[model samples]
Target: MSLNKETIRVMNVNIYCEYNISEKPPLILIHGYLSSTYTFHRIMSKLSENYSVIAIDLPGFGRSEKSKSFRYSFENYAQLIKEVMDYFHITRVTLVGHSMGGQVSLNVAKFYPEKVSKLILLNSSGYLKRANQLLILSSYLPFFHRYVHYHINKHDVKEELKKVLFNHSLITDEMMEEYKRPLLEKDFPHSLIRLLRHREGDLSSQDLNQIYTPALLIWGKQDEVVPFKVGQKLASELPNANLIAYDQAGHLITEEKPVEVVEQILKFA
Candidate 1:
């Protein structure tokens, strides 16, 4: 597959994205906290063969321009997706969101149902109540929020990846570099802080119930970050959804089981 990386100015922000043009009803891949389009690299080629695959670095993450103007809120990210879709002249899409991406997908499902024809939440965040008192309090103090993610070296990145992604063999040195790329950014701390504090304002149970879009929930049975029970709760809450729990996988199920994930997505989307 040809790698096509492009950038477009969106409201003064330089939004970077990767695209592979193909069949219609495009597939929009959204990544979670501290991640960019890199997280969806493995599956992008496979999906691109069948459908147009568009993966974006939402404002603060990946190669996208990060500034204080665009607050790292779910609604903001959802709006960005809408803008990108409009720019590309895409009328509808099959939205696939993993982790924090799931929250943004839910926000779009709640507000912009016309743009999203299908919704897939993979070990998504934003379901459970996540108001960390320490984090919240730290956000108020100057530079304290910055201090939280200031020290991100390779060792810590690997250890963090170990918790989220099962199967240590997949955690190669090159993979570590890809995961650490965004961590080295000067504004990474601010982006991390925004995600840490504002992520709590995610979809509620009522929001899940209200999402009538055809949805698929693929989760790892051993997901330590979000937990399998959370996926279960979300599947039950969603009016039209199916939950598929895979064994020997964790929060980074997309990376762990890309083949199965692509299979599931192809079957559903």
Candidate 2:
């Protein structure tokens, strides 16, 4: 159950990851925005027992390298996942993505269908609810930029961490520190701004129609980030998909309901 961590160079960038190779097609874990693979710690070891599991810190997050020059688009993120897969010579996989990672996973299935066999989305963010015009605009002004920077740096990430799940008591000092790590990284702020600036509406119903891969949607009914209603609509739109909602949980279904999430993932796969 111990995950072996490694750093491998890909396209001149060093990518950090923890993985275990077992069977042919592996279960790949993709973390959300401002998050590292550490969030998946609760479920990875158990799943790794029966399936080849790989969880990584996408570039600019976690232990991965960050560079202002790198593109932060969903396509770019998906391509990075492909690079990792190719590095391991893994051709087919079942992708498990959370929030922003879900958006990347959808793109991967849309553009690289052959590489994905099944998908598991935990409160995925393919559907953009509404845009914060002020925030996006503020990212441009120097004064506002520094203001935003200070806000991000000083914000008690634990407050938001509490929102990610239903129970605030579950928030741990270790988890708080892990989520705060990227904010301290030099280039992470710029990349975060870039991602926010590029934030667009959700994929159109027509656009989602193109993803024919079977998918499992695990959502928390109280999810504030991406509502359970979004998950319901997504399930209806995906050609082959089903959704499971936990009433007491919030956005962080994996952390809020790890056993349920892992059970559904294993059952679906």
* Candidate number achieving the greatest TM-score relative to the actual structure: 1
TM-score of each: 0.93, 0.92
Residue 243 C-alpha lDDT in model 1: 96
Poorest 10 consecutive residues of model 1 by lDDT? 145-154
Model 2 spans > 4 angstroms off:
129-145, 197-201
lDDT of each: 0.85, 0.84
Q: Candidate 1: where are CA atoms >4 Å away? A: 130-137, 151-155, 196-200
lDDT of 2: 0.84
**Model 1 C-alpha lDDT per residue in residues 92-165, reported as the tens digit of each score:** 99999999899899998888998899999999985556667886777879876456665554358889989988
The superposed Cα distance between candidate 1 and the true structure at residue 1, in angstroms, equals: 1.8
Residue by residue across 100-149, what tens digits does model 2's lDDT show? 88888898898899999999999998667435998778778775546656
Error of 2 at 24 (Å): 5.1
